[model samples]
Target chain A: MNEKVAKLYQERLNRYMTALDCGKPDKVPVSFGIGDWIVKHTENNFQEIFYDWEKSIKAVDDILPEFDVDVFGGGPTLWWPPMWDAIGSKLYKFPGMGLDENSTFQFVEEEYMKAEDYDAFIANPTEWIATTYLPRISTEFENPSSLRGISALIRSSVAFAEYNNYMGASWGKWTVEHGVVGQFTGMTKAPFDTLGDALRSMKGILLDLRRRPEKVAAACEVIVPHNINYALSGAGADTRFPCFAPLHRGSYPFLNPYQWENYYWPSFKAVIEGLWAKGKRTYFYAEGDWTPYLEKIAELPDKSIVFDIDLTDAKKAKEILGGRFCLIGGMPTTLLTYGTPEKVKEQVKRSIDELAGDGGFILGAGGVVMGDAKKENIMAMLEAAREYGTY
Target chain B: MSEKEKKFVPEPGTCTPWKVKMEELGGIPGNEEIVKKDWERLDETAYNFLWFWVHR
Candidate 1:
């Protein structure tokens, strides 16, 4: 790294963490919420990068230099199609393997785990995961996941290690080289979200919650430690990159307080606390409307967590989270796709007024850049922040 | 190039649903108009709501 480039990276990193410390830096920090939009922006389709890591980096390089975002959220971490195809990922569809060559990789949700399997799941998760879950989810993993004997275990273990080495090395190179402070260490999910998203479809989980609450709760317990362990051990030791735990199913319009409190909050909070004990902080992309749960959110360690909120009014979130947490986003994606440059500025001004008030705010869209977002508006989104957001 | 295709989330949550040709997923028959209107309606609601939030 050039001396100046490294210094610039550290300066940008410091500016971001300072806001997280609830201090006003020289200016407001803005982080990019990238997606396949960059692929389309660079005159390519999703299939190009979905198939190759180098292409994904090219897509990042094509557009990232245009804007100076304080944090790079590892723009487009493409999955290893071979690994998912082997494991029988219940939630993914990639190019040519399942969809057309030019098609964007998609997530397919199905109820893979049945109610009766709760016993099998709670019995020996590691064994059950290798034998039952793997094969049931992916066609190729059947023979490997059987673990009928030691040879089978060795085959699957070696296969998994190779897959891990491939995906981990590529993703790490992109995140470390591109990420300023560090890349988000790894992704985490609320154990219930994991259960809902993968094992059970959203509908399946909702019904299970109503029909067999205890089984689902018990299943969630078995998965919590795994989430914590992965977050802590999945990446480099003592890295500044906080593992991101995106709360999707727990967001508003999806759960009642009774359901959220009993099922989601405790386990998710435990995982955060678990990482916290290891000196790890978490960056939560509380997707969708989380205004209803801001009070519950305020209970976590002050300044140790950064909350990137969506849909919730920032002024109200700040009031509830006053000095108890740092806030990252409030600019809605709507403003970027349809609003004019002036409109984008106005929203940035409002975010400054609301979230950037006590110096805990970093201005950004609540979610990823819309794959169809207007180029002019995206530029405006950044420009407005720099102009009005200077502290 | 269909107007219905113009606005359907076709996939999960992003705006460029057409980025993937969703022919395999097929269409929800009654949703054509609902999507067209909502596409315009939601965009308008969001922009209008934001326009007011900033000015207010």
Candidate 2:
């Protein structure tokens, strides 16, 4: 490690530790991670790069160097096709919508489970992820030889961190130098969101929430710990901080507060407590309105972090959670995508004004970068943070 | 008073339809009685009035 970067890392880590407890640090920390929206902005032809890791990393490398974000985050595992692939699903692309625009790989071949087969499906998920799903990825990416070659190429590539440990080392150094604290692990979605993607059919999960409440709760209980375990396993003890990106998606507005309390809250509590036990402080990226559950979340270990709450007003969030946990994010991604640079800067300034008071605040977009977000707008957010994020 | 001019008065101490639906679904377990008490505080007119007021 560069001596300067090492010093910076220690300094920022100390500051973050102090700030986590509601104490003011020497300076406010700023960081950014890779999100799908920013990826789209960097690539002219994202679809082509989506399947090709080399191309995708190239796109990321172009942006990260310029952005100088405090923390670096890895992209989603493209090891398999779209998530549905695990369940014998495939995706078809529609041009112009970007990577997320792809349609599900239809379950036309055969139903993996009968309605009665739900029990069998729950008993073992590894069978699905390994035999059923990984085979498809092996078929698509066919070159273990080619992958090895690409891995070597990435060693030389600026965006090589997807494959090499250098990115982590460099980011660790950047955090110290910039006086920014680094969150070691990527974000975890809420258990319900994971269920929608990995465990049940999206429609099946939503219907199950209404029709079979006990089953939904049971399934959530069974699955949430695994998600927490998965996150912790990736984040070794060396990195004390654990973070998750829990996108709310359809599950947010669709479920009433009653369902949220029974199904979602318990699962969430289990994960948070589980991570806390492992000596990891969780930065939960709550992507939707969490106002109804604000009190429930406030019960988490003090000094945990919550990011990007959608519908909950930040002032109210601060009132509810300011003392208990550090609050990060609330800047609307829409303002970055559709609004002018000036608008983006103004919103960032507003976020700093509202949430960055005292301590326990970081700034970021409310959600992942969308495909439409202009490059200039993203830069404007960074610029605004630099100019106004002072204590 | 005209319909628009009439002051919208909500039933005091009532639960909204969402709360009612939640109860019917067995969503709120231990707090059912408390929810019911809060629900019973309002008449139908006041209930609807406050329902829109709190939710909207």
Top candidate by lDDT: 1
What are the per-residue Cα lDDT tens digits for candidate 2 across B1-56? 24323222111222233454553465765767776555553333232221111111
lDDT of 2 by residue, A251-315 (tens): 34767778777777778777777767777667677766776667777888776554445556788
DockQ of each: 0.01, 0.01
**Predicted structure 1: lDDT:** 0.68
Question: Taking the tens digit of each residue's C-alpha lDDT, what string does model 1 give over A47-91?
Answer: 766666667767765666566778766656445564454445445
**What TM-score should be assigned to candidate 2?**
0.68
List candidate 1 segments past 4 Å from native. Answer: A86-90, A100-102, A145-179, B1-56
Docking class of 2: incorrect
DockQ-derived CAPRI band for the predicted complex in model 1 = incorrect
Q: Report, to 2 decimal places, the DockQ of model 1.
A: 0.01
